[model samples]
Target: MNREEINKLFGVTDEQLDHMAAEYESGKWEGGVGPIVPGRPRIYDEELETISFRLPKSRVNAIDARAKRNGETRSQFLRQAVDDALLANA
Candidate 1:
């Protein structure tokens, strides 16, 4: 993908990528570019994927209320709920 597509898909800024490049070029490069990894690092050694589904209006409103009470966005609240559920099953 092009840089613009990459930025949209990976949530990385062009300036950030440029800074990384400058750092790399400043290195010794003794091995001559052995390996390269793009994009930002994942949190908690975990990769997250986005999923979409429809929910009832009432359920959405309830989730929003609880998320607000917990000081989290709807996505964060849902992610934590799923994580908790997975742990419980495990």
Candidate 2:
């Protein structure tokens, strides 16, 4: 649907419709289009893969404490550590 159609349908001004259209085109519609509906597919990039590993309670606490000391989350600390290790090994 075009901007004019959207403005007419939603009883909004032409400028508002143009702004909405621009936002949609830029993929900034986080709450989804128009009214909420069930089974609407969410589109996002799949560039990063999620991995989970379990460590001992002590190790987990240590990691969390170290991360807090460095003013970073455990995940961020692990990511930085991995990047540093990889670069050092290379």
User: How well does each candidate superpose onto the true structure, as a TM-score?
Assistant: 0.51, 0.48
Off by over 4 Å in 1: 1-44
Cα lDDT of model 1 by residue, 48-68, tens digit: 677999999999999999999
lDDT, residue 70, candidate 2: 98
> Model 1 compared with the native: what TM-score?
0.51
Q: Estimate, for each residue in 20-81, the C-alpha lDDT of model 2 and write its tens digit.
A: 77876676755455643356344335556779988899999999999999999998898888
Model 1 lDDT, residue 22, Cα: 80
Error of 1 at 41 (Å): 7.9
Q: Which sections of candidate 2 miss by over 4 Å?
A: 1-46
Against the unseen true structure, what C-alpha lDDT does each candidate score? 0.82, 0.79
Look at candidate 2 and tell me the lDDT of residue 47. 54
Return the TM-score for candidate 2, rounded to 2 decimals: 0.48
